[model samples]
Target: KLLSVGALTLDTILRVETLPVHQGKFIASDGLQIASGMATSAACAAHRLGAEVSLWASAGDDAVADQL
Candidate 1:
């Protein structure tokens, strides 16, 4: 099975020590969300399932596109 379609996004996630309490404050970011593209996720899953997969995605820059 091969998946070849949909949008790709670079997810930016922040892990705050707690919910924002003030206008100006700082929190510790434990991790960042990334590559949460639905289709791309699926394609990667398919590949892991032992299927040849190719992802077809639309991105701003080719460099970013290549990451997909």
Candidate 2:
């Protein structure tokens, strides 16, 4: 089994045709939101590779943590 210990963070990804050069309103064609961080990501990868994985991430007791 793999034990991953680190921070677990919530991430947001947006798909856009192009990056804006100037500050302006923008719209996303698609997007994904997920919980990811160095160790958490590693744990996920290990699990996908058929290994038993566990994650030990530090998180605050709040909405963000609940989402994780």
RMSD of each: 2.8, 1.3
Candidate 1 least-lDDT 10 residues: 59-68
**Highest TM-score scorer:** 2
Off by over 4 Å in 1: 20-26, 62-68
TM-scores for candidates 1 onward, in order: 0.65, 0.85
Please write out the lDDT profile of model 1 over residues 1-68, one tens digit for every residue: 57569978877677887788778877666876578588878887888889999888878776655664
**Candidate 1 — what's its lDDT?**
0.77
TM-score of 2: 0.85
